[model samples]
Target: MKRGVRESIAVSAVLLAALFILPLLVIVPFRSELLTREPPMDETEGEPFVSGDLDSRTVLKVKNGDTVEEMDLGTYLVGVVRAEMPASFAEEALRAQAVAARTYTIYKLQTGGNHGSEADICTDSTCCQAYISEERARANWRKNANDYEKKVENAVTATDGETILYGGVPILAVFHSSSAGLTRAAGQVWLNDLPYLQAVDSPEEGDTIPNYYSRAEFTAAEFKEKMLAAFPEADFSGPVDRWLKNAVTDSAGSVETVEVGGVTVKGTQVRAALALRSACFEWEVQGEKLVFYVTGYGHGVGLSQYGANQMAADGADYKEILTHYYTGVTVEPYSFALPG
Candidate 1:
């Protein structure tokens, strides 16, 4: 009877252990709700604009930013890039750039030159590139350090979608540029057909071109003086207009034509016109040429991706960086799943 009791006790202990272990098995298969669910939408969408290809130029019209300007293809040519680039990447980069340039131009033309339906102020990095979190950047660096070549030959490419409705018009190849994490060729600051804004003395190997001054660059006194000196013609009641107020080049002065990598650019705005360069940024009037060292890149209208990355690294949140660049904007969801 005692032996029988001992066997029964041992069996009961084994059953208890099995019961405890069973719960763990169930827990092991169950993923956390946060991990399993789709991540919350990136809080960058305010006024959604479609970047599309019309005619042959690639273009984007943001809600509050400038109208869709034709993207240039020659800017990505092999010899054009100022950075030290690998020889293998030249052909692919050139080809991809050409295709994108042409596609976007077509999109603009098709939509009657618009990309946003409303003038909703953009408040997030969607109008530009998204800021990668510190942990994310570190993880990316670890995975591809010195070897993550976004160069066309090895990188995976994707289109935002084939068609997007910009201002209710159906457009083709309406996609986004540069993934949220990587800076693209579009981030390069350029003016005219030149990749680097050239100085009259000539550009050195490492000098930053197109250097424009930030508002902080000017003290209240210096700012007043420069504004007065720069535009003595009058009207200083508001902000000093730094960009091209009007086409500096007249109808006759504009480039009647432009050739990109042996292919001709097909838009009107991308003519071989005198675009502001380093000299233009400084507003220097030399020999009837508008010369000033310009700062930053692109149109100076959108989120500066490099600037955004720097801000992110400096511990500024994405919202702060977006607000700094895009004035008077609000944040919202900008998912591609929404029907246009």
Candidate 2:
């Protein structure tokens, strides 16, 4: 071969070798560290640090009495899971709850939470995620405390450092006690149209679950009084049936709008005015009282706890359950940097 041709061939061989060997050189050093690292500790009975690429030591400002105390993120989740869902639920459902709780906490931390304190979140279910101290939860569990604690801890450990994300950011992982056979889109229930919170069928929700159906009865005088209080301009002179006419509902059967005493009001407004369980309700007059038969519970805007349990019962894992409820979401290991 000519000298030029021979030089060109030598250069090509070197480039080919570099392309194949450089990646190995980069990865080989970390391989032993990756392989020999201890398996994540058993979280059932001890304070096992979360294993991930992100910081595991999250500090939570917890409101206890008038003073606030900082808590570990994992410990806080145990209490949150206990308050949010029943321990008797399937392990997968509990694991899903753990991830949702973590995602919610991080979201709140990212956005300024409504707690109005130096807290990342609150224990109040209405204000934020519900939580009970380990002592109180164990007390409430009574004879089943040990078993229940083990289950919740196992769930938290199994999904440690995991969160549901949309577009690489933690999402608003809102959840409810139950859904009306389907989850509602965020736009349908709220003013925002979050792409990840679209409506999805949750077929597992049905009459079999407790409080799948509920009734609230009020005397004509009482109903009239409540309506008048909410809508001062409401004309309550006619029969009760006419008062709640023209109920326009969304695709999920939740009352979106209705004519109450000649005033147009949203079903959510009616639910709040009457302390109803959900917007998915029907009202009727029986003799002298107004009766409301309500289906489902909670705001019906996110993962249904009962529905998740049913899915777990049907063999769906935590990842499947989370993805099913949160449309187009990825369950990925995440960690947030803690403040010094």
By lDDT, the best candidate is 2
- Model 2 off-target regions past 4 Å? 1-55, 338-340
Q: Give stretches of model 1 more than 4 Å off.
A: 1-272, 278-280, 283-293, 338-340
**Residue by residue across 35-154, what tens digits does model 1's lDDT show?**
687867434322222232221132232232343322222221111111212213333332333233233333444444433454212212334212222233325445442232233212
Per-residue lDDT of model 2, residues 1-340, tens digit only: 6999999999999999999999999989999998889977434534443532232477778765466787778878888999999998999999999999999988988887876656667788878888887678777987777788889887887888898999999999999888888888887667788989988888665767887899999998999999889999999888766777999987778887899999998888899999999999988889888899999888887798998999999999999999999999999988785555
CA RMSD per model (angstroms): 20.5, 21.5
Model 2: lDDT equals 0.85
Collision count of model 1: 32
Each candidate's TM vs. the true structure?
0.25, 0.82
